[model samples]
Each structure stands twice: as C-alpha cells, then as structure tokens.
Target: MKKLSFTTPTAQKIYNDYFNRVSRCTRTLPEDDQREIMMEVNSHIYEATLAATPQTEVDILVDALESFGAPEVVLQALVADKKVKQATRTFNPRHVIQALYLNISNGVGFVLFGVIYLLIVAFGTLIVFKLIYPQHTGLFIREGHSFAFGFISELPGGLTELLGNWFIPVVAVLMVVFYFLNTLLFRLLKRK
Candidate 1:
C-alpha cells in the first residue's frame, strides 16, 4: 500500500470545514480546547491520508475521520475533560432558529400526538367531573360567556346557544388554518 498525502489546499479546506461545523454544533468548549480538538482532528485526517490507497486520498481520509467520530463528538469529549473550564453558554439565535426549523418540520406529527393526548385528558376529565358533580357542568356552561362579543343583535337566544356549542369546532378550524400558514412561513424561511 502506497503512503498517501494531502495537498495544502485539501488540508486547509478540510480543516476549515470541520472547524465551522464543530463551532456551529457546540457551545461548551473554551477556545484552547476547541483548538486542541481541531488539532487532533487534523492529525487524524493527516494520518488517515498517509494510510490511504491509490484510489482517493480525500475520500479515504474523510471516511477514516468519520469512522472515528464526527467533529461534534470530539468537541463534546473535549468539553467534558476536567482540564477544560466549564462556562455557562447562551443560545445563539441562529442555532435556536435552526432547531426551531427542525422541530417544525417534524411538528405535524407532534401536533397530532398532542391532539390525541389532549383528547384523552379532556375525556377523562369530563368523565370524572360528571361522576363527581354532574349538576355543575350544566351550570358552568350556562353561566359562561358564549361569545367574545354579543354583537349579533338579530340572532335568537337559541341560535346564540348553538353557536356557543360550536365554539370548539370553530377554534379547531382556525388552528388548522394557522398550521398551514405556519408551514408556509417555515418553508420560506428555510429557503432564505
């Protein structure tokens, strides 16, 4: 097996890419610790390159480095090392927003799960309430304000009561509409 070598350009590119990705992913490591981790990563890359076959040096180096662990893993380990001083890190807006995007992409499933959970809770609560104090439920509804504003002067009292009964369904329709709008906004922001 022939010894491999990385050109200056290739080494620099690999180092910079690794550093940027690592910095973006982690918030714990001090500057010296981060530098040490990067140095170790570059050493790995260099060693892997020297061991690579004739097919491709870059590919082999990348595969070897990845096999060891991702840059993020290295950063985590370095941060955990006792020699490194621990500091409270604030969340960067870019990181927070990226996390939000990831969550929102998977949010439809989460929302559905939440809806089912909420339905179960509501049903249980209603059953318990009825069993404990059946008369109170009707009294509570009767006393509650059905509408945000009693503006429909022409409507009969029976019609108002029916509208009040449909309040939950109306809110459900609004929530569905808002979900679509939020999805659209998320897509647009991601593109930017």
Candidate 2:
C-alpha cells in the first residue's frame, strides 16, 4: 500500500477556498465563528483524504466536501438551528397575525378577481345568446319559465339594447359584489 500526502501549500489553498465559499453565503456569523467552522470542515476533509488509497485522495477530498453539502445548504441549516433556539424564547401573537393576514388577503384577493372575471364571461355569453337566437334565449333558464328576459332582443335596433339593458347592469352588479367580497375578505384576514 502507498501513502499520499497533501503538501502544506495545497492544503492551504483548499482551506482558503472552502472558507471563502462558506463566508459568501453566511450573513450573521462573526469572523471567529466562520473561521472555526472552516477549520473544522477542512480538518474533516483532510482526515478522510488520508484514509483513502493513494490514487483516490483527490476523489475522496472532493467527495467529502460535497457530502458536507453546498455553502448555501450549510448556512441554511445553521440559520434554522439558530431559529429553533430563539423560537423557544418567546412567542408574539401580533407578528403571527400579521403574517397570516398578509397571506390570506393575497390568496382571497386572487380568488375574488377570478370569480368576477368568470361572471363577466357568463354575462357576455348571455348577451350573445340573446342576440343570435332570441327565441332560444330562454334555453339558458330551466323549463316552465313563462317569460324569457332577453334584454338584447328587447332593444330597438338589437345592439344598443343588449349593451344598455341587460349586459351593463349585470356586469355592474357583479363588479360591486366582487369589490364588496374582496373588502370583506381583507377585513376578515386582518382581524385574524
């Protein structure tokens, strides 16, 4: 069996690169802590490399660093660990409520807008049906209805009647309902 040694210069370069990469992703660590973590990781890599066969030292070193995970992953794990520690210290109801409010308001606003858009589509379709097939306009409603409310057909010239009588009011009412529901949702989210 043969032995492989990493020269002092090679080791220095490897250690410096590791530290630099780790430091780039860490925001809260002091210089001392950062240096200590870098040293620990470098030492682990070196030890693993020594145990590998002579021809496998380079591969082992690379594998060890990769197994330690990327710099971002390391920083995230450290941050999460710190959070777990701090989370046990206190709980703030206001902050939780604020986060919940923001999330719910944004979610509900999207749903309300989508519903209003669909309603406008439905109203437009009704107008088109009334104009193209006035007799069949009542088909949209269930059987047994005595009168078919074909606003578009009721117009003097057809086009104006559709826009003026039914389509406009239906669209307006839908918009009002959408705005009211959105406002109510916003208030409910904020209250939570």
Candidate 3:
C-alpha cells in the first residue's frame, strides 16, 4: 500500500483510521485485490479532498469520507461481490457447508433428492450383496420361501447371472448422470 499524504495531521489521522477499518474488513479477500481496493479508495479520498478547494483540507477530507459511507458498509459491499465471484470457483469447506444448509433449509427438494439417491444405492448394494454371497441369495420373497429370481422359476440361474452382469454398469451410469443432474439443479436453485 502506498503512503498517503495530507496537509493536516487531523486529516491524515482520519484517513488512516477509516482505511484501517476498511482494510480489516477486506482481510478475507486476496492480498493483491485487497491492496488494490485500499489503494483505489485512498486515491478517491485524496482526489475528492483536493477537488474541494473552497473548504478547509480537514473539512473536505471529513466530508469526502462521510459521503463515501462508513468503512463497514463499503467492506460489506466488497465482501458480497467477492463471494459472488468465488461462487463458481473451487469448492472449500465453508462453501460446502453453506450449500448444504441452503438446500436443506430452502425446501423439501433436497431431502427428496437424498432419499431417492439412497434408495437407488441401497438397491444396487443389495444386488451386489446377493451376488457376493451366493448361499444367502434370498433377495425376493415368494409365497412360503425366499429366493433370487424366483419369478423366473424355470430360468432362475440364467436370470440372476444376467442381472448380476448388467446391474453394476447400469448403476454406475445412473450415478454419473444423477450427479450431473443434481449439480445442475443445485446451481439453478441457487440462482433463484
């Protein structure tokens, strides 16, 4: 940050105080960007005070700072803009938590999405478990017995083998498609 000069000690002190508060508020921003903003604000202050030639320098400085608004208000605007810029950037823990909270709080869509996903995963897992444990392959309930592919009684083995071969790939494709769709939906919902 460049050192700013003022004709009076009171003006210099006031400018420094206001900028210090602004700097503190912008600490969450990138270092270079923060420096740039501080410099820009400082330049604006100097120009405004210098242009107001009829008033005392201290009075001009005070009026300029006041007109620019409080540091806290300026900081809030900057921070909000920064957050919007970062929204599409890489994810961080803070962003993840914020997303989860927003979705869960906004409506039942998030819960429904989660439940549907869980059910799909559970069905896929159950099939995998039956395939792995051949002896315990009771995935379906018949009139008085539990059996795998019981509906295809004449081709039980063939049906089970066919499902076992294709279930994993189908589930995998569904997962990828759902992931993309969910992400798209989330982004759309957030914009709303």
**lDDT for each residue of candidate 1 in 1-192, tens digit (9 for 90 to 100):** 122345666855765676577666444445665566656666766676667776555676567768767766655444433121231122233432333433443446434433543454454454444445443322222235553322232343433243334444544555556545544543443344
The TM-score of candidate 1 is 0.34
Which of 1 and 3 is ahead in TM-score? 3
TM-score for each candidate, following the candidate numbering: 0.34, 0.34, 0.51
Tens-place lDDT digits, model 2, residues 1-192: 112245565654655576678767543444555566656666766676666666544456667667777777765655433332232223233332333322333466535544554554575666676557654443223333433344334332222122334544565576567555644553453344
The best candidate in terms of TM-score: 3
User: Which sequence of candidate numbers ranks them by lDDT, best first?
Assistant: 3, 2, 1
Better of 2 and 3 by TM-score: 3
lDDT of 2 at 3: 22
What are the clashing pairs of model 3?
A: none
Residue pairs with backbone overlap in model 2? none
- The runs of at least 3 residues in candidate 1 whose Cα sits more than 4 Å from the true structure, single-residue gaps closed, are 1-15, 25-27, 82-84, 87-192
Give candidate 2 misplaced runs (Cα > 4 Å). Answer: 1-5, 8-15, 83-192
* lDDT (CA) per prediction: 0.47, 0.50, 0.62
lDDT of candidate 2? 0.50
